[model samples]
Target: MPDPTQPRKDTRGNILFFFGVLILLLLAYHLAKELEILYVSALFAVVLMPVLHRITSWSIRGYHPSRAIAIVLLLLAAALGLILFFTIGLPPVLNDLRGFMTDLPGRIPGAVDRLKHIPLADKLGVETIASRAENTAAALGSYIFTSLPDWLTHVFDILTTIFLCIYFMLEGEHAYEFFLSLFRPPARQRLDATLRKAELKMSKWLLGQGLLMLTLGVCSLTAFGILHVRYFVLLGVLMGLFNIIPVAGGVITIAMAAGVAAIDSWQKMFGVLIFYLIYVNLENAILTPRIMRSSVNLMGLTVLVALLLGTALGGIVGALVAVPTAALISVLLEEYAVQRPSQS
Candidate 1:
């Protein structure tokens, strides 16, 4: 109690500063949560800049492209990509679907016969396997049908992300400079360098990812075609597209492919499985390491951790940008903590 006589130390300054910092942190976290779309747009813009830069450097019939012309050409390229996807990927899938529906009734009796052969199935007094399968199928159908609305929202979000990305690509320089202006000169310079490094790495991922997809697509296509598998083109393209999703995607697509193969015969199914087993091992041992070394340059554990953290922080969008974000954080830590370059 006697300490009160020693000039009551005004704690206002320290209290105010602490509260200010807390407010800033809370604001940053809230903004991150609310503006995920904007962040994702910025990420896509960075990844696509290399492609845009290359396109901008091209000439139209020996005439240099103006900014508008470059934009036109970029849009055209996007259109071409969509056109190819619909033409090459969608038709075979549709054909397979139609054929499956047409043949499903005829295939039912055979499926039932096979199920009836299951040992002890009758001894346990179980219902027909066909009935069990039908019930499972009905439940799955009900779930899917119920989720259509959510899927539509997801598709809308994707389209919006694309639109935002294009807008950012077209006119992001001003905004970028505005962001840089928030920091001091030295801090801004370091930030610019770190961001540039991140951009380059992300661009490399775009190229490497495309290469991996193409490799898988071609290999799967050729192998499935040789095996006379139904929906070979469809399955191949699906495998390629699914690779963007990492671990679970490949497994899901391969399982679907195997299911389709089983419709022909267990021999074809086993052959397909064997091929994928060898291919996955080869990819893990040889393909991914060689191709990604110059690109992402991340260890397997780093990637896994990045993905987990990103997913936790940003959901699907976070997972999408995880590797590049990790790369950016690594660059910052290196520049500041490891290198400690002399400040000018």
Candidate 2:
């Protein structure tokens, strides 16, 4: 029998342990922003690790790249793309914006006058609506102009994230091993296996999502160009970049496109809307089913729910990684939580 002097439990020790946990929780709450950046950086590293491995494994005349070299090559390619965008693709868009801003004051009167011709103009207070829109646009412009410091801070955060992601890519294995060491052997092994499966799913997800983004971008570019939409290039780029966010991204971009088209003609706006409608249908019925379904192995409902929950919790960044995060959680749940049927 156990010694009665040992006592059934150490009440003081238990209270102290719980108090320490509460202190840690408070610290975590205060440091949430930094934690968010670290989380996102680690996630991108996990998603890209397989690609880095593939690059390292490549042989050109028996020459294989080291991990550092492979990372440099990827960074160089990304830098080149950015340089090209700044030099070529961004100029016309910038010029158009400058011209539009300059002409906005002159155009507002004519725009309001056009609205006067609408059947419900008086009842709807169209002129008042136009005045408010003008004021809103001016305020938006002023805010942007005044927010240079904030924008610079965001740029610094982005650079910090990139550097952290690179560091993670280089040292993540060691960190992962250390993390696993915190658990007992059996649990550690099980977690390692589960995380490896999740990594595979995440890498596949990045590739599949990339292809979808490119497809939508190219199609938007072609359709908008044929219809002679203003700022088609800019719109197309936005469509592709924002498509990473799923449903809301597409809706926001399409609305902007339709509004731009409406500046010229109602028919053009309808055309833009119709194109997006058809594309959404085709994507849902065909492209997504073929590409994402195979790659993610997730149901439509699961993805939607994940996206919604992620957005509610972490905004745009959360939405960006939500599917892959869900994949990771799903694998863990299957292994540790979900009930399995007994064999007959």
Candidate 3:
């Protein structure tokens, strides 16, 4: 008979469990690092699951769509959107851009002349800017030409991700089932429930983010209008679009706004900076936490670290999926790793 106080050992099972955990970590890291296109595609598929399910289930002319037909319809809708954008949106933007470029040379000297009157402009070598501008423009042009190959590579990766997303959307249910099969029946039930929770949270995030983007865009447009900022519409549009990427997005928009403002006057530039500073603080402190309430439960530090790690792993796509990925990881950790108080 075994002693009542003695603990039972399961050495072989423990060793196997350790190895399984190690392998999973290695596999996750490898996917995040090397095969980010597929990784992001999978994440995209998860996010689009609700939409796909709805579309597939909905009847048009008394006919429900097959998975392939649903996938094709989604792709076609996306293609239609691009076609509309090119036909409707691109011309006006191109015209404005062409007008801006035509006026740029004349505007530069005026800007430089105005800069000469500014405080400490002499000390800052403002006079040298005009001389350097031409060389700088040439260098920028050369850099853009040289970077074409890299740009094309990026485009290729985006196309591959899109293609993979289509496939994932079609067979995502099967893939999800296969994932569930990796565990015992009880474990599968738990995991299935956890993933559903994550999916709901991610869906909420999509809605919340869209609302935030719209609000920010409207605010940007109003602020720029009040300040009589040039290219206000384009800048506002950019602000809204970039705001999708979280922290890094704000920085890029701020820089662009500041540069555009500087072209007119330092006072306008300062005003733009002040507006952004106030807006960023307000959004971060108020809007973001409230809007992203579901994700806020993950803690600020975890989200920041996730963004950093994801960016390090796979650039923009990683960053795009970072918050959801972190949320999913948090769900797993809470379900398994975290110990809870037992009710008496």
Candidate 4:
């Protein structure tokens, strides 16, 4: 009645606008899916950036950075090769693992018997404790054997990650520049600041983490060797690698070590547990504070939140990236808040 043709045009425009938004959202989702690989690759580069920087700088004095990087890669390959060789070829290591699993249930009652003779058993119900420990060991053994196949499948993913990491190391700078050029000047400046903050945070976190792992591994290996634990080297290496994960990793490593030690003697099992507890405390109180304070200044609550969110989104890899990503977000948001007030 008022203007039928004008109403029709308005409806058409609305429909087109909604459709365009839908298309854009679909494109964005697809891009995000593809970006997972790129994100992982970038993380690897960030972890290695400190080493890369040192190598590149040294190379500017006549040595080739490419060659230096190649050497570093070669060394890494050799280390991995050695680990594989030991894990595969060493009969004692295999035998120890098999024996530990097969005898764990039997060992628990023996430990309880020994515990009953101790002074504290009369004060606390030792029999109940022993029963629980035995049940837990059996459950753990069953879980490990059940999950082994799935764990093996993850090896393929590891290989893919390694390849992507190598590619990123080779092409990271060029890729960064290309990405920056895609944005307008103001946006590019903001993006560059975000990237730098993230990169620095990630690099420092990873390097500090690596050093912490090395320290813990060495200390653990020394303790094991002193106790004459079977497959000390293998156990140490496993602990070191798993230590990359934050809270859960130490617990898992200690539990496994204790279970394995139980096959020998309860005294040894208890010793391993005590040692790990002490080491974890030392790491948390001394080493982590000293190393990570400058890099990741987030409070414990923030870290926990980031970890939970990361685990929800992408599993272990996501968890690894979550802290730095949150830190970057925090930095950008703070900057934006300050700048907005000034602009107003």
TM-score of each: 0.77, 0.90, 0.77, 0.73
RMSD of each: 5.3, 2.6, 4.7, 5.4
Candidate 4 ranges with C-alpha deviation above 4 Å: 1-35, 59-61, 67-93, 112-152, 229-231, 258-270, 337-344
Local distance difference test values of all predictions, in order: 0.77, 0.85, 0.78, 0.77
> Which numbered prediction scores highest in TM-score against the true structure?
2
- Predicted candidate 4 versus true structure: per-residue lDDT over 100-171, tens digit per residue: 667767877776776678887867987888788778867886798899998998787677776777777777
Off by over 4 Å in 3: 1-34, 57-63, 92-138, 218-226, 274-290
- TM-score pick, better of 1 and 4: 1
TM-score-wise, the better of 1 and 2 is: 2
Name the better of 3 and 4 by lDDT.
Answer: 3
Worst 10 residues of 1 by lDDT: 100-109
Residue 291 accuracy (lDDT) in model 3: 80
Task: Give the range of the ten consecutive residues with the poorest summed lDDT in model 2.
Answer: 98-107
Best by lDDT: 2
On the 0 to 100 scale, the lDDT of residue 262 in model 2 is 71
Candidate 4, run of 10 with poorest lDDT: 66-75
Task: Look at candidate 2 and tell me the lDDT of residue 207.
Answer: 79
Give one digit per residue, the lDDT tens place, for model 3 in 196-310: 8877777667667778888888888789879988877777777888887777787899798887788888888998899998988898799878889746376878878988997
lDDT of 1 by residue, 1-344 (tens): 57874453557666788999999989888787447888788887887777777777887789776656666778798899989979876888778656654554455556556546788667654446556655665465457668989888778767788888888888888888999999999999989988888778777876687787888888998999999988787788888887765665678889988877877787888889998999899988898888777667778788789888887887777777777777777777777778444754
